[model samples]
Target: MVVDGTYAKMWISKGILYFVYKEIYEINRIMAKQIVSQRLQLQNENSYPIFCDLRAVKNAQKQARDYLAIEGAYMTTALALLVEDEHSMVITQLYIKTSNPTYPTRVFTNKEKALLFLQDYKE
Candidate 1:
């Protein structure tokens, strides 16, 4: 476990790093860096798929979203996001289209589907 806060919680499962945001909080570059760093330290791998549970996240700062969508690509083989609302889905899709992440990225309404999609990667 790298971070356990009122906003987000991070852990690993089956070699896949998981980040679950529990509340609405602005994600800045510093927070993104900490997330990537903790993922690296906890997973101890060159790269792996990330399953993000963003059902609770109200919004993410543009700079932070940009950094994670672009530079954070190197740390992840792919990204699977589970979003429960249309607003978040649209926001994530917009980021994907604008940032053009090198890695595969997808959004799902359920964690099961997201996990299944991420499982396709060898990691």
Candidate 2:
């Protein structure tokens, strides 16, 4: 199943949930909640490894990051963040360092590597 939200597009394939952020959007707390809610709906109570493509995201507020790290982890087995540019990389790194997610989470510059990482956690 696939779902498109204000900040990103989400889909599930195999046992992985994919979230691809829209180009140049600033994510706030409310947006984070909405995104996670949508993801929960898509998953339908089944947990899955998540692959998030954040290459296009411009900015993410600290509240949003915190909410995602805590609340957004529902129905998620693990998380793989795909980043291309330095900006996205920094954001991903910051999220890891500051939020300290309970689930296994990693950042990758290569999509294939990210997928391979998430595959291990797929249900």
Q: Write the per-residue lDDT of candidate 1 for residues 12-51, one digit (tens) a residue.
A: 7787878887767567788777766665676665678889
- What TM-score, over all chains together, does every model reach? 0.85, 0.92
Off by over 4 Å in 1: 1-7
Q: In candidate 1, list every pair of residues with a backbone clash.
A: none
For model 2, how does the per-residue alpha-carbon lDDT over 20-123 read when each residue is reduced to its tens digit? 99886688998899888888998889999999998887778889888988988888889999988767777678869877788899998999999999978986
Candidate 1 local distance difference test against the native: 0.77
In the predicted model 2, the residue pairs found to clash are: none
As a TM-score, model 2 comes out at 0.92
